[model samples]
Target: MAARVDVKLAELGISLPRPMQPIANYVPYVVTGNLVVVSGQVPAIDGKIAVTGKVSWSVSVDQGKEAARLCFINVLVHLKAACGGDLDRVRRVVRLGGFIASPSEFTQQALVMNGASDLAVAVFGEAGRHARTTIGVPSLPADAAVEVEGMFEIE
Candidate 1:
């Protein structure tokens, strides 16, 4: 079956752009056996970071959440590409890692990360849920307020 990710995206009125090329020296994704590991995805849209700076100081929590959502969308794009656009090839979402550029005192990492987690479940049903880590970071590439990475098990 083809990936339903695109359909869900269309339901949201979103169209995932082609996965962006890696910046710096790292590859964007790697497949090991049945597992596909996607590199950290910034909140970039159309090759540009949509928002920058630390949350609370320069960006709001809501904005960070939006960024997290975008990151997940990008992840799905890569997943679809890796599996030939067949989401049914996915067996499980093994894990997700999220980094939020925020003040050291901020304690809402879990909430911010949920933005992506919820979206995953929305698209893949129960298979979308996974082990996750949300951490507050001092900074990130392009000074993006949020970045998310994903891992999936393919059938």
Candidate 2:
């Protein structure tokens, strides 16, 4: 039998990417009590960053959105590990923090972040509604266009 969330992922045509090992010393996720804090995830597919450069500068808004969604998919990969490989253990998506590589003049970080937020709702329904903070940063690790970190409440 598949986990309920696993079925949902299949229905959404989302195959959770293979887990990536941390490049630095920090762990990918920390589970303390009922909360799982996922580390920042870059838009890497098959271990290679899919998008790079600054939004509204070298990267277009639509591309940035795709990068954001990819980052969230990586976040989900880690979150599943934190939940013992069962996404159905998730109770709610408490929060998500999005960091976008952008110039100081760029002001559409929120719109770019919608990529991740929309997918969250699609996967988790109402439980995915979360508080979010979107920031336009000068750069992100590996020059990735987007980075996403999340806090999830799990059963």
Candidate 3:
């Protein structure tokens, strides 16, 4: 049987890709005590950047939202690994940090970040409601439209 979170993802028509390997010197996730800290994830599908460039410039707001969503899915991938492939071990989504690549005038980072936030709630239900910080950045690695990192409490 699938885990409840996996079922939820399937219901949403999302099939998580293989977790992306860290491109730099950091591990994908680190478990300390009962917490799992996921390194920032970019919008990637099948090991390729799915979305790139800045929002409100090369990427539309809607596309940016989708990018954010993909980033969150990647976060989940790492989280699942940290939990030993059992998402059921997750207790709560502690926090999410969002970075939106956007122009200096772009002020809708929160709205764009909702893509990830909404998916989190849908996947984890009440436990998904989490504190978040979203900010616009001038650029990101690989020019990804959005990046997300998370902290999760696990059993």
The global C-alpha lDDT for each of the candidates, from Candidate 1 onward, is: 0.86, 0.95, 0.94
Query: How far in Å is the alpha carbon of 73 misplaced in model 3?
Result: 0.6
lDDT of 2 by residue, 1-155 (tens): 99988898899899999977888899999999999999999999999999999999889999999999999999999999999899999999999999999999999999999999999999999999999999999988889999999999999
Ranking by lDDT: 2, 3, 1
Q: Which digits, one per residue and each the tens of the lDDT, describe model 1 over residues 35-129?
A: 99999998888888887999888888888888899999888778877887787788889899999999989998888888899888888789988
lDDT of each residue in 1-155, candidate 3, tens digit only: 77898898899998878988889999999999999999999999999999999999989889999999999999999999999989999999999999999999999999999999999999999999999999999999988899999999999
Deviation in Å, model 2, residue 29 alpha carbon:
0.2
Query: Which pairs clash in model 3?
Result: none
Q: What is the lDDT of residue 12 in candidate 2?
A: 88
lDDT of candidate model 1 versus the reference: 0.86
What candidate 1 gets wrong by more than 4 Å, as runs, is 1-3
Which of candidates 1 and 2 is the stronger one according to lDDT? 2
Q: Cα deviation of 9 in candidate 1 (Å)?
A: 2.5
Error of 1 at 82 (Å): 1.1
Worst 10 residues of 2 by lDDT: 16-25
